[model samples]
Target: MKLAAATPAAAQVKADELGQIPVLMYHRIMVKPQQSLDRSTTELYDELTRLAKDGYVPITAAQFVSGRIDVPAGKHPVVLTFDDSTPGHFGLDAQGNPKPDTAVGVIERVAHENPGFRPVATFYLNKDLFGMDELQAAAGLKWLVQHGYEVANHTMSHPDLSHLTKDQVHKEISGMEDEIVKMTGAHTTTFAYPFGVAPHKPAWAEKLDGSYAFQGIFLAGWRPSVSPFDGKFDRWAIDRVRSEGKVKEDDCKQFCSTAWLDYLDKHPDERYTSDGDPNTVTFPNVLEDRLAKPYRAWARVY
Candidate 1:
């Protein structure tokens, strides 16, 4: 027998549209345990399975920043972001399908097993482009974009911009932009800080007139990000929780993906829940003040 739906969105689900969203940051997907940040193929699969069981759907970082969190009623939006264009993150097998051990591969597998778990993610790239040759790199990027995945700029070299001159910062970012366009023909609208920190002048990496502009800049932090429609949301320095189990560093016991996800599971009201209607933002009437002024016209208070 089916239990009754919780809250009231179409008499079907929870609709706290103003709640926090988990923007998970990943680094590498390798076989065997190597480091705290490294996750094996099975580990990746298990984590995603947990999310699917918890009524979460994957969306690209670009979509999150642009206020395009379109999902089913009662489903929460989660951004699965991978940094550094490593082969472990994406690659193809002899059959032209995503290799089963890569990040994309695991995502596809999980999505296949769990209905409505979109097999899409945002990958931040350095100039190496999966350490592949020019032709292979181009093919990989083309495949990702042709699908629903987002490919965004990291930099020419994943350098610490805080130590470089203003010109150097511009070169590092613009160089990757030029290369991305040259290879995949898709312009990136988002950026991830090389080390979760910005350039000394910040502006050098934020935008460049007519050449490069970003809808959002992400940081390697540990926390659920507020909705882009929230009045206090900061697109320039968006937070991303590292996709890892608990650790001693950075209060990971209370803040890493595992801890955060557990918290969200226990406290559903604090996380973003869709109203099944993409055109309008819906939430509890008490959160009306939290909605940004620009998004007022689309607001639906319950």
Candidate 2:
């Protein structure tokens, strides 16, 4: 007797479930860093390899925020977010190419070697982009967006938003968006709070006259983020786990990569599994009543 093939709806139902996405955060990707935020190139590459081997696909923070994960079925989705516009994060060489040791270079190389792996990441940039020449910075920023990478705001000077006045907060947030538009001719819709400090008021995310707005705002986290499709999703206060080695001041519980990855290892059912098809949304029948508005309409209940 021949076995029946799975229909699209059945396949989607099988893929349907609430996914816990780990938005891995990184600072400077370099060797011999002066701060805890700095991660060595080898460490970076190793992490990327591990993610690829574990069937993780890199998606933009915007995509994750929009609840539109489009990775292949059976694969998990992860967002690689690089904070700060440091030289080591992303810069060009004398040949006008991505520096090999830079975050961009390493991601490009890793994706090239790993066929299904995508060389995409969200770079939360400040006014000073990689400390490159103005002309070079503009070209580089353009290149980043054109290559499927996201350029987002990390404030103009990485200020602590909690203490600033509303006007000051606007300057810190909208000012950076304006500058990014001027440099790259693109508008950034996402933001990351500097020093992991969120504003006291909701105005920080609102768009006033002549001020910019953000669809998603990130905070430093020691844990994985809930699926945007979950009822508990909070776009303004998204959490991200850091990708760094051991450090004294850092809280490894939910802030480090190993902790979260290990957590997922122990609780495999809580992890996000794609339906291998981007057009259809899938989730477990248990979460049928908790699906968000955007996904509720099309999501298949397994």
- Backbone clash tally (model 2): 10
The number of clashing residue pairs in each candidate reads 0, 10
Best-performing candidate as measured by TM-score: 1
Q: Residue by residue across 1-302, what tens digits does model 2's lDDT show?
A: 21223346546435644778999999887766676777898889999998898888999998888767888877889999999888888887889778998999999999988989989999998888898878888999998998999999998899888888988888877888888999877677788889878878865555656657678888887778988878888998898999864444577755589777877868767888887666555776666666677665567654
Error of 1 at 224 (Å): 0.6
| lDDT of all predictions | 0.89, 0.81
Model 1: per-residue Cα lDDT over 1-302, one tens digit each? 21122235443565888899999998888977587778888878999999999999999999999897899988999999999998899999988899998999999999999999999999999988887899999999999999999999999999988999988998999999999999887689899999898999888899987568999999998799999889999999999998878778778899899999999989988999998877778887778879888888777766
Estimate candidate 1's alpha-carbon lDDT, on a 0 to 1 scale: 0.89
Residue 72 error, candidate 1, Å: 0.5
Output the TM-score of candidate 1.
0.95
lDDT of 2 at 73: 77
